[model samples]
Target: MIRVLVVDDDPLVCAHLEAVFGFADDIEVVGEAYDGAAALESVLRHRPDVVLLDLRMPGIDGLAAIPRIRAVDPPPAIVALTTFDSDHHIVRALHAGASGFLLKTTPPRELIALVRVAADGHTVLSPTVSRRLIETAADRHVTRGETLARLAALTPRETDIVACLGGGMSNARIAARIHLSEGTVKNHISQILAKLHCTNRTQAGLLAQRAGLRPPRPAG
Candidate 1:
């Protein structure tokens, strides 16, 4: 079963998540927290597979708490919960080590699927949010030659994988696009993360974006 911890300041939201995941046979709602402080305590106590995090809260917001949570041994995949998808908070959350982002109004079915995807080391960017991120990235004209130069350390195949990752493709899709086995794609992703010093593919993408690179389009 995929263990999950739900964190949000709203009691109604917490209860809603608990109730939603309660019926999932493959998922277990292990614990709940009202704020960042409570989240830290609940997470250490439960060690869940994934954490549903709210971007804004009373004390420590989600972005600030990300590094702290990552410092925890066996850090869970953090999927941020937010109301607005177009804000800089989404980018900050991803940069801070969040694996995925879901608008508060996302359908429960879609949210559950994304949670599963994140737990499996894959990302599920909301289509609308993703399009916006792409446009936002493309509209910026800042220079990042120095950062892109770091790609020199990667092998040719790994470079391809990184570009695709920045474009937001699943490992399975990348494998298909690159004509390699999914296992091979997974290994390449691991190598890219290590070499890039990124916590996850989402961060790696942001790094590439800041480095002045546009991720390749999703393979047809």
Candidate 2:
């Protein structure tokens, strides 16, 4: 079972998240906090497997809370909660040890899925805001050498796959581009994620972009 701690200053948001978790048999809301300071206390007491954290919490705030939470022994995975995808706090949260960044307005089902995915050490960063995080990071400059080194560990074929992922291509599109089966692409992605020690594609893509893994062919 996945034990979740919902941390947001708004009680209604906390209630809604707890209600959403109620739909899943495998997840349980173990605790709720209205601020990062309170969240930290709850986290130490509950030791939840995942934390749905609001970025703008009072006191410590989500961005400041991440590393603190991570410092706990066997820290739970953290997913930053924001009202919008492009919120600048997302990157700060991610860099601070958050496993995922999710919008508060995400569909109920998807929000539940995000919790599960984060619990399992996987993420749906393949699309949307997650993709934008990496794309923007690439356009600017983040850690490059680390990403290049990680990508270099892949075989030529896997390197091809990583490039596609970094370019924000879906598994289906990558399969079409490389003439490989989608299942094969999935396997490659799995390997890439494992090798990079990244929880999700957004992290991997940003790393790839930092490494300067550009698409091999011109886009039509």
Candidate 3:
């Protein structure tokens, strides 16, 4: 089972999330915290597999708590659960070690799926949030040609995979999209990571964004 800790200052939100988890047999709501300070204490106690965190809190808000939570020996995957999207805070949270950035408005089923994604060691983003990141990257002063030039080491297929990753497609999805087997997609991703000197898919996604690449569709 995927153990999850719900951390939100709003008790209603916490209870709502717990209720959502009840629908998914593979997920268990292990604990809840009202604020970031209490979140830290709960993490130490439960060591959950994932954390659904709220960015704005009374004390030691989600942003401040990110690095501290990540410092734990077996750090839990954190998914920012906030009402805010299309904000720089989303980018900050991602850089600060959050595995996902999700709007509290997310549908319950999708939110539960995102938790499963996090537990599987993949980054998650609300569809709107993903679009915002692509738009934000596109608005940067750097030209697309200039950005793409940095990825000279990648082959054409690797480049395609990177774009898919930027769009937040999972291996299975990418395989179906490109008419390749899942194993092939995974192998390509491994190669892409090695060539880009990235440690994980999230880093590859960031690099793809830096290279002026965006997925054809928003993250699902």
Model 2 quality (TM-score): 0.70
Across 1-220, the per-residue lDDT of candidate 3 in tens digits comes to 9999999998999999999999999999999998888998999999999999999998799999988898887888888889988557766787677888899999998888888989987888886675657346332565767657767888877888888888778888788777789989899998987887664577678767777686554335
In candidate 1, the residue pairs with backbone N, CA or C atoms under 3 Å apart (3 or more residues apart, or in different chains) clash, namely none
TM-score of the candidate numbered 1? Answer: 0.88
What's each prediction's TM-score?
Answer: 0.88, 0.70, 0.74
Error of 1 at 156 (Å): 0.8
Instruction: Write candidate 2's Cα lDDT for 1-220 as tens digits.
Output: 9999999988998899888989999999999998888888999999999998888866788888888888888878888887867636656666677877787778888877778878875444413475546456443443566557667878888887777766767777788888889898889888887987765565676676667687567446
By summed lDDT, the worst window of 10 consecutive residues in model 1 runs over 134-143
Q: What TM-score does candidate 3 get on C-alpha atoms? A: 0.74
Error of 1 at 196 (Å): 1.4
Look at candidate 3 and tell me the lDDT of residue 158: 84
Better of 1 and 2 by TM-score: 1
| Per-model lDDT | 0.80, 0.77, 0.82
